[model samples]
Target: MNEKLRVLVSVDLDGAKARVKTQGHVTLQSIQGLYDVMKRADSLVPGLALELDMTLAEVEPQALEELRGCARSHHLPLQVDPLQRDYRFSILAPTLVALPVAAPMLAAA
Candidate 1:
């Protein structure tokens, strides 16, 4: 069967409640919500190729790791697409999150 991979881009949080200066003010809780939504989609359609944008490139190593763990636990291949031209990689997210550290990415919600 030819299955299409489902792709979700980190295009600024949708329906944000707070009146922030810009859409960059995305919070962890909000991200978690996105995870929740993605999880639901997975449940409904097993084996769906799920993908997400790498919000924090090289800076948020910890956050990348945590997301990796979450992806591994769910058996989903987590990825981080670098926005900068300097780096171009498709590193698995599990390895990053499994480290003895937490790279929490938080902002005003």
Candidate 2:
């Protein structure tokens, strides 16, 4: 059975951030709705960070990962509250750094 997806967007009074609350089941089929809501929120408050609260929503693991990937690729500051106490998930994007290579050691003659 297909579950209904509910998305609510609310911006802060200072207009510095927007909070998106989602309820019901969040699957691949309903991911577009979530994205649309986020897009609209971003347009309404350009340059502001978005916080996604999925505490009350039932989200598929794959869909959750996809959302994180999308947020990172788009450089969007998205904070997610999965509401699962057993496992912890970070919403912040990880920083990538290049390590220097050491010179190869010469064999003894």
Best by lDDT: 2
lDDT of 1 at 54: 37
Collision pairs in model 1:
62-103, 63-103, 65-96, 65-97, 68-93
TM-score per candidate, chains pooled: 0.36, 0.63
List candidate 1 stretches off by more than 4 Å: 1-27, 55-61, 75-109
TM-score of 1: 0.36
Residue-wise lDDT of candidate 2 within 5-100, one digit each (tens)?
787877884957787887777777687777667766766656667777777677776777787876656542233322211211224321221133
Candidate 2's C-alpha lDDT?
0.61
RMSD of each: 16.1, 15.3
Give the top-scoring candidate (TM-score): 2
The CA lDDT at 20 in model 1 is 12
- Candidate 1 C-alpha lDDT tens digits along 1-109: 1112223433222321111111121233334444544544444434444454433222134545555665555442333222211111122222112224368879988
Please list the residue runs of candidate 2 whose C-alpha ends up more than 4 Å from where it truly belongs after superposition.
13-15, 75-109
